[model samples]
Target: MRDPNPSETASPFGPVISAYSRADAIADGVLVPVPESIAKEAGFRFPVALTSAAWADCVKWTDADSEAQPTPQDETGRLWDVLYVTAHAMKKAPGDREFEVRLYRVPRDGSTGHAKPARLKSVIGPGDDLSPVITIMCPDES
Candidate 1:
């Protein structure tokens, strides 16, 4: 859906976020920059809360034909301190779209490089003085 403010837009699937610039941070806030092509295909001026990606040996998720559950494991096989960005995106095409907000690991190099996926545990609502929070269960957590 189109937002009243042209500078920002809402995600049809998840939280509305502006385009990610060098200044944006994942842990700092929820807003993040996603693949422009993906955003364009999803008809979102802003970045979606979640998207599929593969980095180095890390694979958040892929465009699988079937909807199978993900294993309770990370790409690293161990835990790593990473930034978490919650966004949403259209899984498929417009006519047959599946909107979802999956947590993604923001790369440490400040570059949208080969980042992994953060296991989605829960979606927490914003507090009286807080915004929407996406709770991710990282491997590092006991």
Candidate 2:
């Protein structure tokens, strides 16, 4: 029997191309998976992850970073700030699946400064299994 979907059969345009999946992104380190417990504590109902860029920018704190800055920072605290702000932003627009949140996090670079305001884009979209999942990334990211 012929399939109703054009892509199911031979495509008139060209051969079908395989696309990268969310699992592939996670495995490739492009997406960093957040602990389910932490996510739930932040009011997330589905699995949540952060883009590599976002993770590096907001959550990657180290001993060197602490010594460089006047105030100390930790990965756990930074991660919580990101997730908590994101959850609050989601609540502000419950009907929207995609939104942007502004958050403050100290830069990990060897620069002595206060927390810088940054924008993160949040998307509640399908995962590799077609289940609802949330991915937090920089505004410039996909």
Best by TM-score: 2
Q: Write the per-residue lDDT of candidate 1 for residues 1-142, one digit (tens) a residue.
A: 7557954554456764555432343444433334456544534444333212223223343323113323333432222222222223222323322223344554333334344554532223332235433223333321
**Where does model 2 exceed 4 Å of error?**
1-15
Query: Could you tell me every candidate's TM-score relative to the true structure?
Result: 0.21, 0.88
Model 1 spans with C-alpha error above 4 angstroms: 1-22, 26-32, 49-142
Count of clashing pairs, candidate 1: 9
Model 1 lDDT on a 0 to 1 scale: 0.34
| Backbone Cα, N, C clashes tallied per candidate | 9, 0
